[model samples]
Structure formats: structure tokens, C-alpha cells
Target: MPIRFTQSCPTCGRRVQIRASLIGYTVACQHCNAEFVAEASIDDGSGTTDSPIGVEKIAVDPLMARVEEALQRAAKERTAVN
Candidate 1:
């Protein structure tokens, strides 16, 4: 069975449909260029409880991580010198 979920763009609040099978896959928002992943859960028949089917954690881009590290190092060195 195919699962579906909605995700709101962090930048523009645009709603986007995501397939549960695509969980853990990175996708770019067409409206805002923001990247996100899909997560889903199954609703219990009682309609009062839900179970997490899976989580799609967003992966931090390596290039962005490296740049952030460099910036932190530079800031530390500057502070040490001052």
C-alpha cells in the first residue's frame, strides 16, 4: 500500500504531498527551494491513536557542514587571539 503525507515548506508554508515509500529520500520544494524528507505514521482503527511507520530524517549537506565547521574554527581562533 502506498502511504501519503503532507509537508509544509519551511520557507513559504506551501503544502506538498509526500509518499511514504519515499521516506528518507531528499527532495527540493518547488516553491521555495528548501530541501526536506518525508515521514509517516499509520492511524489506528480507533481513530484515537497513531503509530509511527517511519521517520525520514533530513541529512545535512556535507558542504554546508564543512563550511560551518570552518566558520566556527575561525571564530574560535579570533577569540583566542583577542
Candidate 2:
């Protein structure tokens, strides 16, 4: 079976499964037809290059998260004050 990897289409924000063979090649989103380069998923500790790609878990930055929360509170406060 051909290995596949799922990545979100940047234009339409839909998950797209790309053939493993097409990695590093240009491919279009099946749903939106947006063209983009195919990227393999982050390694899952298997250390294998041919592993199937799936949803990647992105690590959240604590400082960035705090900043985002602060910004959101500021926005809400500004709206209330106005």
C-alpha cells in the first residue's frame, strides 16, 4: 500500500492526504485546488523515513500562550471601555 500523509491546505484549511511518493513535490488540494509543496509529517519517534504521515501535535509555547491571553483580555477591555 502506498503510504500517505495528511496536511492541511493553507488556502482552504482542509486536511489533505498526499501520496508519500509526492513528498517534496507540488500537489494541489483535493478540495480547494490550491497548489503547494507536499511536506512529510514530523517523525513519530520511529525514525523511519517512509512512515505514513498523520496529524502532527504542535507544542504550544508557554510564553506565547500567555501573551495571546493577555492580548485577548486587552482587546476585551478596550471594547468594554469604548
Candidate 3:
């Protein structure tokens, strides 16, 4: 059986299975369209490597989230009225 490792897509955090032979190979995340190296380090599940363009997770602001929720509520109310 071929050795397989699980890694998360840096851009989307989707799990991807990679073969041992593919370690240090370039791969594209189907879910996020982000390209990264397939570093198949099976220990601790990090499995991240150098990417052409660095991918960083963005932090959502609490104020922005509240504003979005308010907007959604208003839109739903308007639709119900219509």
C-alpha cells in the first residue's frame, strides 16, 4: 500500500491526501485554487510548505460581523414585507 498523508489547504483549510512520493512537490488546492508545496510530514499534521504567494488567514472584525448581521436582518424583513 502506498503511504498517504493528510494535509490542509493553506487557503481554504480543506484536507487533501498526498502520497509519500509527492513530498516537496507543487500542488494546487482544488477547493481554493491556491498552489502550495506538498510537504508530506505525517507527524503533527502541519504538512505545510513554501508557496509561490504566501497565504495568510484573515481575521474578521466583530464590528463588521455585527454590521453584516444587521444588513441581513434588514434584507429579510424587507423581503417578508414584500
Candidate 4:
């Protein structure tokens, strides 16, 4: 069975076709440089398909944690240096 989905560009409202099987996968919008997941299923009467999965803010959490750790380390290093 072939999977079909719609992906909307974050930068642009342009919609693009994507494969449902590619869910949880990261894909870049051809029109815009925005990247997002190809999840969300949708049925447009013609057939069942997937929609453009919005970019989740999950990766930011880990990145923020790492930044905090680096800042703490830098503070400690500065204190020691002085």
C-alpha cells in the first residue's frame, strides 16, 4: 500500500505531498528551508493521507539543558581563574 500525506512549510503556507510511512522522519520543505516531521493523517475524500507534522519543540529542551550546563561550567572556570 502506498502512503500519502500533506506537509506544510513552516516558512511558507505552501503544502507538499509526503509519504505516510515516513512518519516521525524529518523532512525539509522544498519551497522553504523549514524542517518538520511528516506525521498527521488526513482524509481528503479522494483518499486517506497524512498532513504536515509541525516541528516539535522537543529538541530545544535537551539543547537548553546542555547550554545551561555549559554556562555553569564557564562560571566555575571563571571563578577559579580569578
Tens-place lDDT digits, model 4, residues 36-79: 87666444668545453422322235665576578779999999
Candidate 2: stretches off by over 4 Å: 43-82
lDDT score of residue 5 within candidate 1: 70
Model 1 Cα lDDT, one tens digit per residue, 1-82: 3445766666787877776557768877778888876544454557432454543222235665575578779999999999
Question: Which residue pairs clash in candidate 3?
Answer: none
* TM-score against native, each model: 0.42, 0.51, 0.46, 0.44
lDDT of 4: 0.63
Q: Which residue window of length 10 is worst by lDDT in model 3?
A: 50-59
Candidate 3, position 46, lDDT: 68
| TM value for model 3 | 0.46
Distance from true position, residue 76, model 3, in Å? 69
The most accurate candidate by lDDT is 2
Comparing 1 with 3 on TM-score, the higher-scoring candidate is 3
**Residue 68 in candidate 4 has what lDDT?**
58
Compared with the true structure, what per-residue lDDT tens digits does model 3 show for residues 2-82? 445667888899988766556678988877878888764324336534332211111135665565578779999999999
1-82, model 2: which lDDT tens digit per residue?
4456677788998889877668778999989899998877665558533443432222145665565578779999999999
Clashes in candidate 1: how many?
Answer: 0
Best by TM-score: 2
